[model samples]
Target: MKKAFFIVSVLFYVNSYSQSESKKAKILEMISLTGVDKIGVQMMDNIMNSFRNRDNSIPDDFWIEVKKEVNSEELINLYVPIYDKYYTEEDLENLVKFYKSPTGKKVTSIMPQMMNESMEIGKKWGQELAQKVIQKLENRK
Candidate 1:
């Protein structure tokens, strides 16, 4: 609950500061600056596809388990620099624009909930497909 509220609060704050450019254009500029146009899309797509698994065999009590390993603030601090290196103001402006817009606002509002659903969907389908591929190879052998 607190996490979701914080995300929304930050999004709102960002949006309040940036609205001069269209979000799409800003996003495009970011892709260009990041030099990801060549195959970044494909790479990210592949990564997302790989996130799915059939058994949904994610760590049980995942949040609690993660909390046990390290403090959230410390973990966030570790990733901040890596993220900051890639995230330019233009990228942020675009994100803020999305966060402010009607569709973006709605998406952001449900972002966490949506991710949980997506993970389950991805895992269930992904595992099944992978299993079939393995079975096919075993049969051929």
Candidate 2:
């Protein structure tokens, strides 16, 4: 009886691990299909370029090394668990299908620009709010 139970437990554990791995693979593929990793790389490059433009004190070689250290594969691995936390394999499969469609392609093409513009808007908004707060403080004093 003990031997039978141990065999069954081992088989169950293997099957469960296999399913989990399969789901993780599917989610990773879905993330790839959405062009998310490409966008992340582009964002990193843009930030590095902006920093280089603003500050000549930092050498180009240093930024190059930083980019190498924070490469896309590592970022993707860090991101996979977050996706898995929020989405099931079925959700990922649906997302993969949507991303493969024409509208999805359009969204992917435009998303980076949209994000950049949104960031600019947020920064401007925050600066204005900070100015207002400073003015209020000055008036109070």
Best by lDDT: 2
lDDT of 2 by residue, 74-127 (tens): 788888889989998788888888888998888888887899899999999999
Candidate 2 residue-wise lDDT at 101: 93
**Which pairs of residues have clashing backbones in candidate 1?**
52-122, 53-123, 54-127
lDDT of 1: 0.59
TM-score of each: 0.42, 0.74
Each prediction's whole-model lDDT (CA): 0.59, 0.88
* Tens-digit per-residue lDDT, 50-70, candidate 1: 553433566546534543664
Count of clashes in candidate 1 = 3
When superposed on Cα atoms, how far off is each prediction in RMSD? 17.0, 3.3
